[model samples]
Every structure is written in structure tokens, then in C-alpha cells.
Target: MVGKTHFIGLMSGTSLDGVDAALVSFDTAGPLTGELVHTAYLPYPEPLREQLLAIHLPGHDELHRAALLANELSRLYSRAISELLARSAMSAETIEAIGCHGQTVRHRPDAGYTIQLANPSLLAELTGISVIADFRSRDIAAGGQGAPLVPAFHAAALRHPTQHRVIVNIGGISNLTDLPPSGKIIGFDCGPGNLLMDAWCQHHTGQLIDQAGAWGAAGTQLPDLFNQLVAHAFFSAPPPKSAGREEFNLGWLDSHLTGTESAQDVQATLRGLTTYGITHAIETHCPNAHEVYICGGGARNTALMDSLRAALPGKLLASTEMLGVDPDWLEAHAFAWLARQTRLGLPGNLTEVTGARHPCVLGAIYPA
Candidate 1:
């Protein structure tokens, strides 16, 4: 597939971890074959991360601050693009379009709207390449959750002909895609992933993240706390669902505490909550799924992984790396595939997964 059109994908998930930029090539002669040529990561500066986190909650003069934050994210994205191009030794002119899944500030599909803050037009102007953004709005317009968009990509990229597999991404929020041997695909967010545990660690330990779940592994899980956390309605709800910091943040965790527990115990329970929600979803919906492929930041958590392995006995659990795709960059690559679909006027949303009225091509093109 020489001379295939190259598309760049930029993804910044709710974890507020960093931005991932990947350069992918598509083979036009046959079914879409994505080859990940190069990839790079750009961590958000402390000031910018604080601002973005603040904006998620109601604050003074929010519209103005959010506007400024959007511009800053675009600039950071541009820098990510520059580094990716430098690493790949490819000029911007040679690429087709950039698929940017901007930082999600608010996601409220039940309220009829979702917002991802990034100035795509400014990104196009800065990078001199067309940008495809706002990939979730059209699905929301069609009455859908406008999330877990990666499921469709999982089906195409990771699904096997005879094996029923589940693809789980555990970032700030955890979501999974159910690929049956032969049936429609189903996916939904399974509630908090690192959102609660990371917040707790940052507040008490002043660390950005719990490295390999060491802090949690040192503590013991409070069964009562774990049960209370899992009792949230989001877990038992049907598919076509999604969640964000708005629903499961430190505030929510605080509301559930009795002021007598240790912070380490809380962290361990938070990890238990994540393990429970993810495994519960798999057991409840896709019990036949023999292999569970994990992605996103959670894939690196050794304690979480060990718990998950123990919880789901006799099932194969591994990162997407085993399937030839790096777990860290799968979400970014999905955005690149979504951008390619939009450019070709192909439908990107899967109605079964998002509860949209029908499949629709998702995204707005910001021409350079």
C-alpha cells in the first residue's frame, strides 16, 4: 500500500493524562488496513491541566475561561503534531486530515448535548492540515449517547471470526465493546476507572497517578464502601450509556464516605469498584466472551489487572498489544479511523452501540 493517504489522529481522554498523536496509513486497494507508522505523546502542562479540571465544575466566568482553555489545547495539539511529524520525517503537506478528539469538558446526552473543548479551526490554521472534530454531536443530534465510539473500530480492527471478545478501555472512565462471534456489536461506559482513585491519590499523596496501583495494593478494600460505590444506578442501567467526571468525581466519593476510613483503604476500594464494574458488565452482558482485551491507562495498573484476572477465572485477559495494537494508542487510532470515515462520507456511528436512530457519518470538517 505504497503512497497510501496518511491521516493523523489526536486524542486527549477524560483522564487529563496527555495527548496522543498517531500517524496512520490506509490501503485504498482493498478493505481499510490501518498501519500505525508513528506515534507521540504530549503531557498537558500543570497550569493547563488545572484549568481544564476547574472548568469541568461550575465556576466564575466559565464561558470566558473555557474559551481560553480551548485555544490552549489547540496550541498543545499543534505541538503534538509537530513532534509526530518530526519523528516520522513526514511533512504536513503529505498528510490528509487530522482527527482530533478534543478534551471532553462536559458530556450530557440525556440533556441533549455533549461538549469537547478544542478549537479545531485554529488547529487547522496552526498545522495547515484539514481537521475533523466534533465527532459526537451528530450522533447526539440523532438521539444517541455519542460515546464509546471506539467499539465500531474494535470490531473492525480487533474482532475475530470465531471468538467472542470484549475490548475494555480504562481511562478516567471505563468503557467496553462486545464483539460476538456473529451478531451486532454492543458497548457502553462501565463507570469510573481512574477518575476516583487518581483524584484521591492527587489530593492525599500529591502524585499525578498511582504508579502500578502500588498505593492501593498496600491497603485493604472496605467491602461496605465497595458495595456502596457499585450501587450507583449507572452500573445497572442498560447499554447506550456513558459517564464522565460530572457523575463520578471526588465529590461523589466524598458523599459516600463516613469520615472514619483511611485514605489508603478508600483508594483500594476505588480500585475494587473499578474492577467490579468492568467485570460485572462482562459477566452480565457478554459471559461467552473468552478473551478480554484491555486498553487505555488502566492497562498498566498491575493491581487492577491482577484483580480482574482473579475475578474472571478461566478467561484470557491481555492488553491490545497482544493483538498487534498498542493499548496506549488504540483510542487515538480510532479517532483517525473516524476521521477517515468522515472524509469518505461513510457512516461512523453504530446505532446499536450508541442508540442513535441510525448510523450517521460523524464529525465536522475544519478545512485548512
Candidate 2:
């Protein structure tokens, strides 16, 4: 297969943040060597965030509105790509393809489906590049968690043979990839990551996120409440599971909070819950990990980073900086790599990690 040296991967994570556009450069053949050369995050306009938050669980006018937003998302994605190319002194003609992880409204892997909201066909037409999207359903059809597929990218792009390592992506929902000293690679969504914390921040402070986890740092974790939250079956369930806003969303918070605590207190508990869940998973699954490499939106939380440090004492906890990849762009870069895989018809899932009956090529291609 003929390959291109550049691609644009788009990520509109569960956080409902604006699309994260990454310009990835790669040889896209033989042994995968690639880099997210340039990255840009465009925040969802205020109105769009409200619209997404409103329709998320209840689905009132959302289905109709979602269709509208889907196209709008496509336009936004196209614009981001155009802008990124412009900033990099490139053009649409220079890109090979676009890998877009549409907005994820629901991710029910057990039910044999996962939903990422975006119109890749429209994106393809608008950007004039082949698009690869709908990345989760095939895995789910194989009886696997369609979510957390990034581990495959993590292993290929970040793993080291001699140094046992873990790639922890703390996005709206947190997930981990355990790259063993050998060839075994395992991963799963540990539990709520920045999703819950971000929700609490928005409600209380009118901010998209808790900058530096400042609010959480002011409060203490309510141990009983923390345990109650962790009792969620997702934490106890084995690997091969994936979660999104469906399992841990705004309504999820309302049910858990139940009018007993302030939002700040709730935020503190939520933060504790994520760290506890991640540290526990590491201790259980990858006890030998030499270090934990942090990525995703959660890596920006200075206080959250401190908490993770305290939770996993004596273990080196650092962002992806040392690895020469920015924490913010890892997910976007993963999708870019997946697009390369789709073009090559390569299997993107580890049968061992997702419990798929067989390794299968992931994602569908949209014509330009």
C-alpha cells in the first residue's frame, strides 16, 4: 500500500471539549515511527457545550439536535485541520487522511455497541481527505470493550522491551496500558478520570475544568463516600471493559452525590476515586512497572499529579515529556496511527487485551 508522510487525527473526547486536531508525520509502513508534529485544541463554543450537556442522558431533543451538531462537528473538525495546516505552512493537499474519533455520547461495550458522535463522511468531504472513524463497534461485535483501544497504539508507539511500563490515559474516563517486560500487552478503562472531576468543576465554578485541581486540593476525600463510589462494578470488573460518559456522567454524579455534599467535597472525593482506582490497578496488574507515563487531559491537573504521586509512592510518575511526546496529543496521535492501520487493513486490537475472538482491523473508511 502506498503511504503518506502526514495525517490529521481528530479527537473530541467525552469531556465535550472542542476537537483536538493533531498533525501527525510518519513513514506509515514497515515499523511504525510517527510523531504528532503539531497540535491544537479548539474549545467547544459555549452554546455547543450546553447543548451536549443538555441532551446527554435524557435524549429529549438531542437526537434531532445531535444530527445538527454532528455536521457542525464535522465542520469544526475540518476547520481545525485547515487551521492546523495553515499554521504549519501546509495545505489540505498535503495530508494523507483524517482520523476522527467523533464525540462519544454512549459507550456500552457489553450491549455490543459503542457510539461516537460525528459525521466522518461529511468531514471527509469538507477536508478532502480519506477519513477513518467508527473505531469501536468492531471490537464490541467481537465481544470486547470497544473502548480503550488506544492501548494498541500505546504498545506500538510507546512501549519499551527492557523497561516494564504503564501508559495511563486519564481522559474523561481513565484507562491504562500495561506493557510487560515480555510481549504481553493488557489494558482497560480503570474508572472515571477527568470526566467526573470536570463536571463538578463546571457546575460549581463555571469553568470547563478544575485548573491545577485547585478546588480538590482545598478539601479532603470523604473516605466512606470515596469507597461508595469505587464500589462501582466497572472498578471490580476484569479487563476488556470500556467506559465513557454513559457509565460515569453528570447524572451519575447527581445519583452519587445525592444532595449530601458540596460540589467541592464531591470533586475532592472524585479526584481521590480516580487516583485510588489507578494506583490499585497498577499494583494489581503491573506491579513491576518501572514508571507510570501519564497522558491525556488529566495530566494537566497539577494537584491530580500530586495525588497520583502520593498514591504510588516511590514510583517515578511523570508525564509523556520524557518519552518525547506531549501528554495532550497522545490520544489524537493514536487515532492518526489507527487511520494508517485502516488504510493498510491492519489489526488494531490485541486479542489478549480486548478479548476479541480474533485480532481484527479497526475503523471504517470514508471517501474524500
Candidate 3:
């Protein structure tokens, strides 16, 4: 029988808020089973965050800026990995590989390219461990969206034999994974999660995020604004679709506003927009899923969670924690699992989820 193997996964998601690193162990010989062993996080310094947000759009000397930022991110990733190893009391050599889902600055599968900034060679050099990075491009090349990649991991870790389950990852952009008892897996990017809400909150209040959606909850939702926000074509687009800052960002939100709405009301409406996006998707696509598990930053938003519960009556709404993985670290854990898949020459993406022409082994490896 094959022994258990360990891999470290690092993720700096669309929020561009911080880096999350998780160490996970998996039994290589049998059905997929993952044990979360250790984890660490490091918030982006304000300036770094500002730079990353800026580069999401076109700018002067972008190539130079992106290249430099990629190196900086590699260093940041190395630091997080070091903390994870130290906390776990393990050496770099003891782990098989590092899965780093670098900072995604652009995701445009329709145009046939997605960019995730990471100097994996630098990360491998700094951490003295093999690094697997850029897990999206291969899927895109195969005529796919190259996103919501977690569905494959979701199936391996969360799917049930008899229960119709849905995993909702409420990151900067929300995505859904439907796990049916006896059918093909379905998953896609739903719509706005924390992306617009966080942007609007920062613009009006200078806060990084709404603490448990308190600001939005205290205010009333703007029906007109909510209607307008949901009117975006991406929200209604069919699956095999994905989104990022390019599709839903401050610029798009600004264009929708009349500039007369109260900041808090807009905040409330944005929260409503997020809640609608998730619940609507569930009702439309995964109607049979009675058990819904949420993860990522948005899962922590009390108002958002409450809204979801109220909207989806009769469904069991809970965090991924009930499944033994903390909501906050599930994405990070996925990358670790993906790293293991890449190392073993296994497919890491589900064609059904990404709409790829075929299942593909994702990511490129940088040797230690």
C-alpha cells in the first residue's frame, strides 16, 4: 500500500487581501481523503494591495510592474510556507510539493488567456521545494473557462453517496459546485460575492471589508440598485462560464450608479446582490440539492449567511467546517490537493465544471 504524502497549498485569491497557506496530507493508495494539518496567513500591506488592485486594469509600464510584483508575491508565498512548516515542525524536504495559485490579475477565457502572477521558480528557490503554479491556462487552452477549479477537489472531498450536495465558495466572486448522487458534477461562477461590496465599502468608508456585513445589514436594500446590479448579462449567462475583476469591478459598479444613493443603502443592496446571486443559482441549477455548504470569506458575513438562510428555505445551510474543513481554509487546502494531483500526473480539473474539451492535468512544476 502507498503511504500518505504531504503538500503545501498557497492561495492569494481575487480579493487581493492576503495570502493563505495550508499543509495537507493525503492517502495516495485509495479513494481521496485529505487531512488538514497546518495553515498560515499574511495580509497584504496596503501599498502592495493597492498595486495589485491597480494592475488589474491597463496601466503604463504594466509588464515591468507585473513582473516585479510577481517576484514580490513569490517572496510573500515563501514566507507563508516557512510559517506553515515552522508551525507544523516539518522541513521543506518532508513535503512533496507546493501548490501556489498565484495572484490572478486577469481571467478572460473567452479571449483565450488567464494570467496569474507568480514567480514559481523564485518560490521553489526560496523554499527549497517543488512548486506547482499556473493551474488555469491549460484548461483555457482546451476551450474552457479555467475557473471555479475547486469543483474537482470538492467532489473528491465533499461529495456524498446518497445526498444531493452543493458547495458554494463565496470568495471575491462566488461560484457553485453541484454534487448529485448519480449524475455528472456541475459547477460554475455564479456572480458577485465580496468583490463589489468590499470595493464599495472601501471607497465610501476606507474599510477593507464589512465586518460580518454589519454595515449593510444596518441599512436597507435599494430595489432599483439591486435590480440594476443583477441585470448584468454575466449573471444570467449559461454555465461553463467564469468571472473576475475584469467582469465585475468598481468601474462596472460606478457605471451603474446615479451617484445619489446613500453609501450604506448601496452597501445593503450589494449584499443583497451577492445573496441573490448565490441563492438564485442554487434554485435554478441545483434544485435537488438540499444540503448546501459554504466556504471562503463571504461565509463569515453574518448578514449574508442570514440572508441566504432566509432565501433558501428548507435547505440545510452551513459552512464546510461541518465536513471537517474550515470555511476559510478550504480553498488553500484545495491547492495542496491540486499540487498532489499534478505531482502524481493526475487530472486536477473537471471538464464538466470548466467546460474544457477534456480533463487535463493542470499547472507547471518548478523543481526545488
Q: How far off is residue 80 in model 2, in Å?
A: 0.4
* Estimated TM-score for each candidate: 0.98, 0.95, 0.98
lDDT, model 3, position 274: 91
Tens-place lDDT digits, model 2, residues 44-108: 99998887777567666767888998888888888898889888998778888888889887677
* Per-model C-alpha RMSD: 1.3, 1.7, 1.2
lDDT digits (tens) for residues 1-368 of candidate 1: 25488999999998998899999988866447488889999998999999999999999999999999999999999999999999999999988999999999999999999999999999999999999999999999999999979888988888899998999999999999999889788999999988888889999999989999999899999989888888999999999899999889988999999999999999999999999989999999999999999999999999999999999999999998899889999988888899999998999988999999989999999998
Question: Which pairs clash inside model 1?
Answer: none
List per-prediction Cα lDDT, in the order shown. 0.93, 0.84, 0.92
* Model 2 alpha-carbon drift over 4 Å, by segment: 1-4, 28-31, 258-260
Instruction: Give the higher-lDDT candidate: 1 or 2.
Output: 1
Which portions of model 3 show Cα errors greater than 4 Å?
A: 29-31
